[model samples]
Target chain A: MSSLKKSFNVRCRDFIHAGEASISVQQLLKQMHIDPVLIRRIAICGYEGEMNVVMHGGDGIYCVEINTDRIVLDISDKGPGIADIAKAMEKGFSTASDEYREMGFGAGMGLPNMKKNADEMIVESEPGCGTRVRMSFIIKQSTPT
Target chain B: MVPEYISFVEKFCTGCSQCVRVCPTKTIRIRNNKAVFFDELCIGCGECTRVCPEGAVSSSISVIEPCMKDKLNVVIVSPVLYAQFPGVMPSDVLIGLNEMGFDHAIDLSYYLEMFQYAVDEFVLENRKSNNAPWPLISPICPVVIRLIVLNYPNLLDHILPLRRPVSLLGDEIREKLSHEHGVDKKDIIIYHITPCHAKVVPDRSGLMDELGFIDRALGINRIYPGLKQKLEQVKELELSLFPNEHFSFVPSTRGPLWGMSGGEIAGMRIDNVIAVSGVKETMAYLEKIEMGLFSDMEYIEFRACTEGCLGGPLTAVDRYMAKSTVQKFIKMFGIGRRLPRHKIRQLYDKGWFFSRIKPSELAGVYKSKRKPLTFDDMKKIEKLMSLIHGSDCGACGAPDCKTFAEDVVTEAADLKACFKMKE
Candidate 1:
């Protein structure tokens, strides 16, 4: 048809099946026959945001929205907010544990890759409050096969 | 070896994505919520069958059952096929093949005598040219040929310039039947009673430029028992197993040994020869041979199995028991007492297994046949490529850049593990 919107509330601290939830979200958008480019954008941002919640967030939720017009993903965590969101967003500046590093989780490129791949990206975090990240993607109808 | 077309049943597919995940060529697409197979790029390895959880993957092997119309079906069995019948006499199996729609059933080693002459001539030419490498690998084994072509392609030029044994034998049979029986060439089906599945992988998947070689494969393991059962109903004519054909190629007491280690070099009189039968040992030899580690050798034979075809997993015999039996047969037949002069010399004139290389052709489906990638499609493909790490580690099982990118674009694979950034 035209455009559709889909949202998902990704549990903040679920580590075991973290990627599984995003996979379903990605597959659902794919089944909807959304534009390949838009689905990719949604997927890249959605996965990064979902992973960021599980890896870096305190206790909050992440949401994903998809449609024919554009796709949007929003994630908020009430963890120790990034005192320096700029530093956190830097490609290699990571605050991750050895376990995260062993699991290939904390290269600090999550925010960067999200920004690089998505058409729009926004992040807001308070020092004591929480962090909320929203990203958007343009529906390049034929972005992928 | 040519592949028979396998029907793609979309409805029966569970969308479990096993085929997509295991296909060596990455030719499957998950489009419109179903897994669609693209035959153009398929190598026909049946990797999809091993991966399918639903057991939905099936081959069109039954397509060869028609016996090539009312025409005479002459089947040539490799000597090692003796291992297929276990305790049964080879003549009994020959009778079985005769009952199984075969007008003529002959052992391939008979034709091999002639085939050996061609290889000898090819080696002579190789030495004269001095441009080719020593110890020219045998093309008799299609799997070894494919491995060289696909993996060790640099050694392609060194392969012996002779038509494969079966193809040569096919040509000779065609000519004789055409002249002797005055049979129209089209009315004859020359089937090589085979053991390995490579015989089933067609000479050309339309992946090559030339016409495909051979008509069909009848793996002895697949059809021999059925024929054996059918032989029970036939008139009990104790037909001669060893036909009145003139003897020329009397190999060692180890006739089936030709299917095993030391079979090729020892039997063919290619002195300074070394042969490895099984896969592991052959690969190890190839490594050194390709690297020029071995020298002063006239020929090298690699069978991809220990003790060669006698020890083939498809063979129904204990290895040592079969070897001893073949030894006994050789001693009883007085095979080692004398050598048969090579009487069949016309094999040198036969043409090679002809096929041209394919480069980024997508099995020749160009813009004329299939639509060209649109700019939008290109951008999408690039987007998917970006999803991949570009390392091209073959983790997703697609070999290189374009293939992996294509898979991602087709939605046959997800982009997460490939490009997901750690938090």
Candidate 2:
């Protein structure tokens, strides 16, 4: 089966345009007549990843791949990478500054929420290097009502 | 079958594509030098009717004389109807309807009070139990509900499941008037005096069609001339002539305000309610809600009309003037009656106010049968997008270049329709 791939850029500290990428992806999925439940889950993951990049990571790239069987999202940021991925994955363990926390951006639940929504998630990071997050959502095959 | 509330008169349409630009759902397209309406995509916000400069888009106004002659006609006056005539009070409008050859006229504000109470209770209980979706949406506007059904299906569970005040009032009038007048249930016809065209479709189709509460809807503008004359006559009468009991019952302070934006939430005791009006604003807010935003809000009231029902397409006067009139009437009437908490609770317990609106029922009969786009289709659309100017000029009939490209790729439109491409 043929797959459609799309990419969006997320700039660090650009609060005004942070959610633009996720919203565009959501609209695209809606136009394709994807199941709303699946679209919403994917949107939440996209938004969380986008926000995380803006709040903590450097300028990032968010990409999505869609096919009949499943949809996948890949997000990478060119920022100071996480030193301990295991501790960062834990809920409420945030490295965000006081300013970001005050703005309600760095809630430390980003990775956990993304993991909950995605069928499979893989995070690759190294100190002094950038971070990459990959998430996949299985599309249920059903007759369109 | 979905009732055709809004119709396009081809003779009057100049193919300027004005209606196409304002359509919220992008359902209207210029085809064969005329605008074609796709009924399935329509949410009946009446935006097209409002924007059509040539008056080509007309809302269907039923001829009520036949029903009046055959049945015991009872007119349910919308609060917006009272607001139309500047100096006319709600009671005056009711009297005017009676003078204009109606068996009885009921004030919608009375039921609106009960509707408010029911919603308040529903929100409170839902908050305590955490059983349903948070930030429950108001069910007052039929167009808003239809919008959710068509574009925001994921937010369906957020809609408050309650019958409109008009339906509640219609049910009571039909049941009581038929018995009191010794007429058959079918012999008693209830007509809703509506200010909006969107209200016309729900009575005959959609989730409330099976209830059959409202027999027909009379647009305010259609009946305004005769009703205004009747109200003028009522205005000339002495103020003290009517007996004390006749003017004893009045709607609550906040009920009449339901004709304007932010009125529904004003009546509720809850503090976390947000009221949004206008079709575009409502759609944007719904999109935000779908993205899991606004979690703290307990309720949201959305009106498809810009300034609420006062700004309805069928309104007789300016929306601002109508709003001022309603406000003046409210102030003069002196914060009218309030339903007792016990009474409201009893009705709530009996399930008198609840409406069973299934998701399937809200999904209109004409569900779009278009297949989901494949990767190849997407590629074709992208290619078409690159070939055309993205200025979003309505000369191509579609709202924007993206929609035009999609239409062309889907074979719904000819690629040559793009004026830029021809050049």
Per-candidate local distance difference test: 0.57, 0.79
Instruction: List, residue by residue over B310-382, the lDDT tens digit for candidate 1.
Output: 6643444556776776765655654442324433343244334322333222222311112334334445665
Compared with the true structure, model 2 gives a TM-score of: 0.92
Best by lDDT: 2
Q: Give the residue spans of candidate 1 off by over 4 A.
A: A1-145, B1-55, B62-69, B121-131, B205-214, B230-237, B240-255, B276-292, B304-412, B417-423
TM-scores for the candidates: 0.53, 0.92
Every candidate's chain B TM-score: 0.66, 0.93
Clashing pairs in model 2, backbone N/Cα/C closer than 3 A = none
Best by DockQ: 2
lDDT of 2 by residue, A17-130 (tens): 878888888888887888889988998899889988998789999999987788999999998989999999999889999998888667788899998999999999997788
Q: Write the per-residue lDDT of candidate 1 for residues A1-145, one digit (tens) a residue.
A: 3233334555656786565545555545533455434544555566677777787786667566544456667778877788898888889989888988998678787889888877878899988888898887776645323
Q: Which ten residues in a row have the lowest lDDT in candidate 1 chain B?
A: B360-369
Q: What is the TM-score of chain A in candidate 2?
A: 0.96
Q: Interface RMSD, candidate 2?
A: 3.0
